[model samples]
Target: MFNIVKKMPKALWIVVLAHGVTDLSAGALLVALPFLKAKFALSYAEVSAIALMQNFTSSVSQPLFGYFSDRSPRPWLMPVGCLLSGVAMVASLLAPHYYLTLLFTAITGLGMAAFHPEAAKTANRLSGKAKGKGVSLFAVGGNGGFAIGSLLLATLLYSNVSTGVLFYILPYALLGIPLIQMTRNLPRPEVKQVGSLKTLRASINWPLLSLLGMVLSRSTVAAGISTFVPLYYVSYLHGSEMYASSLLTVYLATSALGTLFGGAMSDRFGSKRVMLYSILPISILLYLFPIVGDVGAFVVLSCASILLSATFTSSLVLAQKMMPNNVGMASGLTIGLSVGLGAMGVLALGKVADIWGMPVIFTILACLPVVGFVLTLFVEEPEEETVSLVVQVSK
Candidate 1:
């Protein structure tokens, strides 16, 4: 393990750490936002709307940023975006009213949106044979951040909200210093000469687009569960706040394990096969979640978490292979658009929960991975490319 870490590039390590810290800050915000809503006397609908704004803004802008990043020379876009996002988060501390808070949160989301395309593009470029491992490692940073943030926020909420808010700034400030050093030493990326979207659309392989759609659908389920599982446990099962939060931690931690496994499997077997096999088990587990009582629910949630997240790296690797010329855009679509748009499913499922109950929502989410499984059939594995001058130089 030490030898393997030694072999990885310094830039990749920096990106991973930076990704983790940024995500940690974001996670802190996610966990604390609910409390903030309660303190402000906001409705559940209003709280959901804030989340919708964050997702909507992030999803729409990501593809555009990704498209431009592919054509641009500025590899520093990642760090700059991170910096702006951190600043935006700091500014959000001053939001005295709910509307102002939403605006600041949206700005923070835009900053996050900006970083992803450039950072993911960099990861794809650096990851040669073990693309899955690389992506998985990056993802683990985000997940770890999320887990830690959730745990810390839950703990702090017992005391004072101001303490949690103040602690959020620490990670971002610490990360900014190292980002400067990493930015200076990085190699310059060559700009691609891809034509307009029409030509690009003509050039796009349909199988790849189908794969994107599968990811989009899968994201709906994943995001819905991630955003609301705690609420379900709390409201439907009459679980304590700590228990609900603990289940969420269990879900996230298991998902991290799944991510690691997915990346490893994709590197060994093909990404498509790994994804295809993982989906059915995940669907089955999710479908079974609400029907089970106490211990059974926890067991099922853990399993679902692992299987669902395991698909993440494989799905991303598949996209990167499909669009070798525009990896930034591809990564953005898979990681950003699919994941971001998937958050909408939370709102949709929330409505379903309101009408029918938690069981129905899980049943609806279960169908998504099956759809992804069917879509996986159409994706063709990328053929080994003849090593062109650009490919050679990129390495």
Candidate 2:
């Protein structure tokens, strides 16, 4: 019997925990936003714009952070990123005006952008022989954090906004201390560091570029679905907020499980094969999502969520391997650019949903993975020489 917990590294575990807490804080903020919207008399469009600002900050900053972390001596970038993001989350709670709220949200996004590329790069480096598993474990933290944050914040909101915001501070403070301690004890790897822009440009290998395209397309679908699922359930299915929220929880939780499965499977098989197989099922489920009614939509969405998340893990593992020298840059493009840009699709899909209907918007989203799957055929896996070149440039 395989003892998964025992085999994982302490550092990986710590990173995962930090990732979760950071995500949880972000998620809590997201869930709490509706309350703020009601209190401030903001329109749906206004609320969405605030959310978009957050996504924009995260998307723009990730690559920049990746570029710097690759060359910087500070091994504490990931932990510091987490701490700053947590502080930003708390700051948002203090915002007295809409503009200030948006500013703080953007700051939180910056924090998130800073943590991921550096932390993911570190996780990939530590995984070495089992990079897939390592990335998967790291991803699970984010997924679980999103789930926990939503649930916890929603529960706390029943009392008051202040209470909900205050609840998060304890977790952040507790988690930050250990992360600081762990980072101090860890030794930095010896590698030739690349110049910021030059390294980032050079790290963009053919395989990595193809994978980034895949990430973007898949992200379009993932982001659209996540942002709209709650509204879709409420409007189309006549579901209660609690039930709709539960469905979202199911989606995130299963996605976490999928990350674990996909990561481990990639280690045993190959990243390409795992990615190829997962996309078909994801596409099929996504296509089926709009047509299905009531509880059936939830079931199909759950299946689609798992496949989508699993493919994400596979893509991350493959991209990291392709640019082993610049794992931060690789991680930035895969998670930061791909996922972040994808989240931005919410704006477009929202417009489409406004005009055509939610089903049509989803049907459009369903096609993204098929594009990604086809692109997968053209993407060649990275070779040893390419990885070595990347390593040299990264140094």
Task: Please name the candidate that would achieve the greatest TM-score relative to the true structure.
Answer: 2
> Which residue ranges in model 1 land beyond 4 Å of their true spot?
1-6, 151-167, 189-199, 386-395
Q: Candidate 2 — which residues are off by over 4 angstroms?
A: 1-3, 160-164, 190-196, 237-243, 292-295, 384-386, 389-395
The 10 consecutive residues of candidate 1 with the worst lDDT sum are: 386-395
Local error of candidate 2 at 329, Å? 1.2
**What TM-score does each of the candidates earn?**
0.89, 0.92
TM-score of 2: 0.92
- Residue 205 lDDT, candidate 1, scale 0-100: 72
Candidate 2's displacement at residue 338, Å, is 1.4
Q: Write the per-residue lDDT of candidate 2 for residues 1-395, one digit (tens) a residue.
A: 14434477788899999899878766776776787798679998888777777778887788778877766645678777887777777677667888888888888889889889888887876676788888999999998887788677777667655556666667778988789887787666755555466656765666667788888888988877777889987987677999787877788667877888888888888889998998877778877776776688779988888888889999998887766656787788888887887877777888898899877877788788888998888777775567676667455
True-vs-predicted CA distance for residue 157, candidate 2, Å? 4.0
